[model samples]
Target: MVCRVSGILLAVASAAAVGGCGGEGGPTSPPPPGPPPPPPGPTIGASLNLRPGEVHVLSERDAIRAFEIQGAAEGREYQVIVMSASLSEGRTTPLRVRARADDVSPNVVPNARTNRSGRDAAIPPARGLAGELRPDRDWHLRQMIETERELRRLRARPAEGIGRASRGLAAAVSDVPRVGDTLTVRSAIVPGGGVQCTANTPIKSTVRTVGEHFIIVEDDRLAGRFTEEDYADLDRELDEFIAPVSHEYFGEPDDLDGNQRVIAFFTGEVNRLSEPESGSVVIGFHWIGNLFERENCPASNEAEIVWLIGPDPDAEFGIEIGVDFVKRVARSLVAHEYQHLLNASQRLGGQRGQDTWGNADLWINEGLSHVAEEVTGFYRQGLRVRGNYGYTELIAGDPDLVAFRDFFEGNLENAREYLSATTEFNPLALNNNTLDFATRGWGYVFVRWFGDRYGPAGPGGIVAGSGEAALYRELAVGGPGYLFGYENFLRAAEVVAGETTTWGDVLAEHFAASAADDAHEALPDGAQFSTWNWPRLWEELRTAGVRGLTGGDPLRRRIIQMGAGVSSTDEFDLGSSTARYYHLRAAGGHPSMIVETTIASGGNVPNSAEARIIVVRTR
Candidate 1:
């Protein structure tokens, strides 16, 4: 809100003579020795003019009085006068007088400073006393009240709109399948080099596209209902799934134990589902329900993939797969789910325990999984891709992100809301919350910093492996060790862009210099400062300036840093005080020698003490 103020006025009052008392016993014996010369009248000054309902304070020295102008309006001008009198007891009495619109003419007395003071002076308008004044109703105040009401109404509707939109979208897409269908086949290939299926068998599988490689499954069950469009959509999705991971390492072959365990695990499941040992997982493409619903399944030791039949896969995961070659849709689904399997295996060592599933490490798990989907060429919406990257980068960048990530991963504060029936296994929980915003933003910054500091090594010298643990370690160890270590990534970014000087250095110098002026002289010794303690001081350093200084003699200089300059002398007289001074110098500039004085009082004896030395960079 912006505020505008008009000019103010100050009015002074003149002394009035007291007439002699009439019919009062010959003037009460000559006014009791002249009544000590009939002490002087009070000097009157104008009250502070202000808008109606506006709070104002009148302060003379330390004594203050607060009042609101009840009759004035915003953008309107009025005159107010203050009359003050001092009593023999050294106390002051005050009175306020005001003039509203049309109460005084604009051309009144042609800017006369005062009316004639003699007995023959013209009589001025009968200005009412303070007791007679009344507050006027201001139209501007009414307008402001109405404006606030309208704004509140306007703000309320958008919130409702957002809630409605969320509900509508959820309702519309709630039934779409979270996982693609899985199919079991009795043979490796048909006479036409396509998948052949046998009855009463099922294999766990998911759909994915990997480059140009295509897998096709054709079964008699799907012959009448499947259309050409369905096949094409499946192929397209397959292509999208394989794009990002085609050249990227989902995990090192060594680390994944040559992928044998992963392949063996899936193959064993396929063998059970298919008759006569087909030796392969055949995917059957279909829709089940929302991603969360699939994740909510209570079955322990159940196969990770399930098959369902439906008209559209695009309705889920926001991917579009044109219809055609229904067999490839099955293959794509297998590939996509396989990637997840591979990722999960690498992260969890191929463990199939229920505890290993949905570990709530969504920032890393989902972020990396989404990245896997992207790298594999899945044609998901750009927003989803960006969102994943944004979150990944955020985690990579800051220690605070780690804290927030841990909080969300643990489902601490908003755990119930996040794990509610309506939203289970939902990555959107993090994205929609304030915690995600801070983490992601900070993570991106940290990743950029890691790139700058380590160069091509790109965080832990491993490009594709999960870098979370390494990044967390680096932040924990490196941040407090150096200035702006938390913001090191941003500093590196600035330096790369030619901003010169790391943010750490700048902050340290500023804080070191500003410490003197704003130092807490009365604070307990050995008190520690944390992030929460420095905001105002930082603002002052940024907006104002900081001064650095050194105290003590040459043998041992006591570094005294100040944001504003500190007085040199420590001595203070009952009548006057002098500031203790220290030598000043700029950061990275020459050091100059100077002298400072110290004065001690109170005549108290000191005792033996012990001290712990701690070194901290101010920036």
Candidate 2:
């Protein structure tokens, strides 16, 4: 009986299933058909003006994309990403946009319809669904969108809109790295009042307050190393050197604290404080590491000057390193380092606090520092001006014969030495020993020559021009056509000459002349060379007719164009045997030549001496 009932129930269930297929009473009748195909995908009758909306979404296909659909208006940039998309098959949503995201830019097409005639409509708006959304990495897309929108709002004039947008973005993202930041290293001592690091390595230390602008952390055990009077005098000398002198040259105050204080660490390990292989007895050195940038370190604007004392054999006894000698050396070191600080801090190519030694030829920076020693009178202290073995003293003797002869010879020798170095470094390149022979020796001579030949307004014009009164304007960049090279210096020389002149021509002419030439002879059957001191040679050149002397042939009038590459000759009668002046201008951009008559006859007679004037281009 149970088996018969089971068969009947099965038959009845199969019949009901068949009826349900054709009946409206079925439990799963097709989902009440989702609201009429979303009104034929809402016609894009007007321009698809999108406006700002709360909901944003990011969808990536080929490239990342971010946008908002609701209320998206024309000419308005949107930052929000799209959260949902209501796209349809056989129908296209007109995505009119000039969009850029990462490396992808898609062009917008106008009048693109969601469907063709008689084709299926777009998916319903209510059917919009969310897909992968990445708002974090969408800034690039937003930036492009903003940039484009701003451009469009300005009537597609990209010059104004795009430029401003780009600058804004750059400014927002750019940051000054801490690559050369400096901290105030106040005087400190470790626990147990241990020794401070100095030339005297193991001496107990006491951080002594050495007044404003400096602190002397001295070795307590070597209290007698330097006297209180010595410190005071040294301090006074330093102040004098920096104020109204070094400060005037750089056109800025010393790079010091508001109180003008600096720290001085006197130690026994002279070699430890100085550069490697810098000899065993180092007088002093400035820490260049504090000026240059390190891999992950910031540099300091001011350099801490270190002095090696009582350790160097020469510095210990009052022999070659007498008290006066020590004082002079210390002051000179201060001046040298201060100039370096100026170079590193002064503006170069629109950049400030840059390493000038790295940017400019090392010879220039080092030469400038060496020149600073004389210009600031650090080398003159404790001795007569002429007694010091400085640039000024080196220029002693007649300005015409001895001084200029010495100058040229020095320049040639130093140049040859530098070029012949086995290291194969360019003469203009900077290095550890750059200042030793060439820079400090010949380089200083050139600097002095520039200053003396041009007066305060000439090539050495840098001295007066680069003063605090001038606001320390960068003469090298904006003030004039000055560059950091010998060629540029020649340009300044011409400017000082008040006519088109080239130093190259002058130098070449000198090189061709015999050492014993009568033209440059001071006395003994020669013209009166300028009576001015050698330090004032530029002033004399400014006033004199001829800039240089050539061959001893006194009869042949040699017209030397310091910066020319051609040659010519002319003959004229000396209407009077007495001196007659003539200004000769020639081709090849040669300077306006100033010629004074040289006659074989001594009397004032219009003699047909057939005076011949030869013009030569030196360079």
Candidate 1 matches the true fold with a TM-score of 0.24
lDDT of 2 by residue, 1-619 (tens): 0001011111222223222354665555443423332221111111112221211111222111112111211222222111111111111111111111212212211222121111112211110001111111111112223332332333221111112222211122222212122223312112322112111123334544354445454544335556777777766765655434555554343232222344454544332322233222244444433322211112222223333343333533221223443444565556655665555434322232232223343445545555566555422232222121323333444344332221232232233233222122233433333234434433444343344333233222323322122222232221343355555455555544443554333322221121112222222211111111331332233344222211111111222221222222222222111111111222333221111121222121111321222111111
In candidate 1, what are the lDDT values of residues 25-122, reduced to their tens digit?
A: 55533323223333321121112332222222122311111112222211222111111111111221111111112222222212212111111122
Worst lDDT 10-window in candidate 1: 573-582
RMSD of each: 27.2, 36.4
- Predicted candidate 1: what Cα RMSD to the true structure? 27.2
Q: Give the winner by TM-score.
A: 2
What's the lDDT of the predicted structure labeled candidate 1? 0.25
- Number of backbone collisions per candidate, in order? 76, 32
Report the C-alpha displacement of residue 248, candidate 1, in angstroms: 2.5
Q: Please give each candidate's TM-score.
A: 0.24, 0.39
Clashes of 2: 32
Where model 2 places Cα greater than 4 Å from the true spot, the runs are 1-223, 253-265, 269-280, 292-295, 298-325, 348-350, 353-359, 378-426, 429-435, 457-483, 487-619
| Candidate 2 similarity to native, TM-score | 0.39
